[model samples]
Target: MTTEPTAADAVGPEQEAVETALVETVVASFDHCPDPRLKEIMVSLTRHLHAFIRNVRLTEQEWAAGIDFLTEAGHITDDVRQEFILLSDTLGASMQTVNVNNVAYADATEATVFGPFFVEDSPRVELGGDVSFGAPGEPCWVEGQVTDTAGKPLAGARIEVWEADEDGLYDVQRDAGRRAARGHLFSDENGEYRFWGLTPTPYPIPDDGPVGKMLAAVGRSPLRTSHLHFMVSHPGARTLVTHIFPEGDPIMWKDSVFGVKESLIKRFEHQPAGTPTPDGRQLKTAWRRVRFDIVLAPAGA
Candidate 1:
């Protein structure tokens, strides 16, 4: 005994009731979805979206423009960059996502958003090697240890590191002949890793695109808080993605990336010794030093 479709369903009336029905249809679709994580995300997203539509009384014209803007954002992606990540960074979504997952930072390196610029297989260098590649900036010696919560040296941990140049740009963003300011290093038996590079400098986010326009509309600067990037991982340990924001950086307290945590902010010590290079050339009038430790969670926990 099948019943006929009602007039409300057949007419597909373009009214508020129709909008409500559309929203209900979307909500009903989630009930049949299987993946717990995906279901959670989609359900929450749909709820918030419906609320936004109701609250703002969003019009078809506005939504069409929003879709077009997103399509344009997609057109901006390339091998070395991602516009959507730029959108997330500009909107503070990246930081929010990281913060939700990293509830505690006790003796642990704070996880930060891995921006689209991170390129793997960065030149592998030895301890005390300089990846600065002659860029102009304050010389810095970064020394750090990778360990477990129990303080055991994380032997053979792969330390993936990258940083922008003195002028605030990554190698992927420029055409430097040499591998500019990026490398990978393995921690030693003592769970120690060291590298020589310029101290991090504050720089702007990609603001020339729609993401940048959005930030400008919101009266925000696109600058990232000054910091260095690290991806430290070991066997049977959690891989850590984090930043070492410079102490006393104006933006340190308000990192645009939301990568800042009390433990990850490191002080740069000014060395008056003016250490000489291997060839005896005076490195700089004032060199900086930073020491920090990273702790990882047990694997598969």
Candidate 2:
């Protein structure tokens, strides 16, 4: 006796042909796009998206849930908080983009995620000045030199820095009109710079939203490793955005945004409370120090 066809068996060449035809139709719709790059991207995106749907055999309910998740992500985003960036970071898209754009050059500092907290028009600071600006954290003396990939000094390069406090909170996360633990300084004629910043500390990404829920659902931690953020820019060189992870951070390998690189990890030396600071500032509490030499690749290299 012959058996009747089941649902799985019924989904054969006819269904596949229909699905493939749909993808082709969508891709063809962009054929008239005037911009070549846009047309290429849209065509590829349509093909990949259709392929994903087919591979998963996505259910209507699952598609609707994804739409809801993105909608909530948009709702939670604001001037200070960027939920979409959080989503991209957690999904590793941000790092992938960084890798694509930041090709490696000899001894050039590796790039990483540009977290959502950076602000425009940060207060400018003199060399050796304090960036902490009264943010609550253990004192940290940070010194560095900026150079080109060829080892030529890059004087006057603007180094923008920011980080969370000892309590793992950025200045923007606290009361409005408050700014601390962040500032910018220009490298001196010798390509050297120094500043007082808070000791690096591990912090959770702002997770009171959809991104947090997704991480929890996937059994993933939202904690980033202890780090300090830096954005170095100079004329005729590619701008560098990166983080320096403390060498001993327990979660350095498990950073929520995958921002840590072995090359970016540096030692933070501890100094006794009574030890004289490099610039002769007296402190009643122990402080840490770190040195990070930055090298920038030539633009468009």
Candidate 3:
């Protein structure tokens, strides 16, 4: 059949040329940016973004929907909630950024997403003090040591820890002016630190927002594995933000944020009721315990 080509069929090469030119034009627009780093970022972003659009053959309707999604995400964000971070975490962008910035050094602990839940000015607890702050969950004894990559103990390291309660909610998610299941403490002279925390339980990342809707549309689960959060920092060392997942957690392989690493998994040993705690705090209910020895890479490593 000899039929004349339609306008759409004839637009291939010319359309691609126009798109490439637009990408270059947008990229060049950042050349005058005073900040060298900002210029590099903008130029690269323009190229990748334009390539994504072209590769997907994105439709106007799809583009509009994406804008609407981001708008909702922004509209719902507040001091306690960060929809944009959730979007990034779910898309694995946050983890990739962490990987790039936290290059592996000699035995330095692997880094993971700095989840949006971390808050500043968390109450300070002494070594061996309770960080649970009366949050609801089985008692957990978390003990660890902070050391340099060379195995030298690093005393006076500030260790910040936080976790959700049994009901899968952080203190920030509750009524305003509430705090629980989070605190900061310093390592002792021996570089040893210990505190009471809730037994980490698997929970869905806040799934009631736009990010949740997107996950549902894609048939993805929003559940994070059982884990405890820690941020450790010391002089002349790279600050470490990571989570320790319990060994044998069924969902460990499917963490929604893709934060799991084999080295970060530790066994959560069970203690029978009436078992003497490390600090001799008598707890009538059975509790769990875990130890995490942290190694920090030197700054600029």
Which of the numbered candidates is closest to the native, going by highest TM-score? 2
- How accurate locally is residue 132 in candidate 1, as Cα lDDT from 0 to 100? 76
Candidate 3 residue pairs that clash:
none
- TM per candidate: 0.86, 0.96, 0.95
Best by lDDT: 2
Q: How close to the true structure is residue 280 of candidate 2, measured as C-alpha lDDT?
A: 93
Clashing pairs in 1: 205-222
Q: Give a tens-digit lDDT track for model 1, residues 1-301.
A: 9977643444344676877888878988989788989988997899889878766767799999899889989988777669999888766798788777766644666688887778766788897777776666787888878899888898889888888887888877786344767788888999988888888989887778888777777787778888888888888876787888888888775655566777778898777656654334466477788987889876653
Per residue, candidate 2 scores C-alpha lDDT tens digits across 78-136 of: 88889999999999999999999999988899999999999986899999999999999
Off by over 4 Å in 1: 1-18, 30-37, 103-106, 176-178, 273-284
Give the per-residue lDDT digits (tens) of candidate 3, residues 228-254: 999999999999999999999999989
Candidate 2: clashing pairs of residues? none
Specify the poorest-scoring 10-residue window by lDDT in model 2: 3-12
Measured with C-alpha atoms, the lDDT of residue 175 in candidate 1 is 68
Model 3 lDDT on a 0 to 1 scale:
0.92
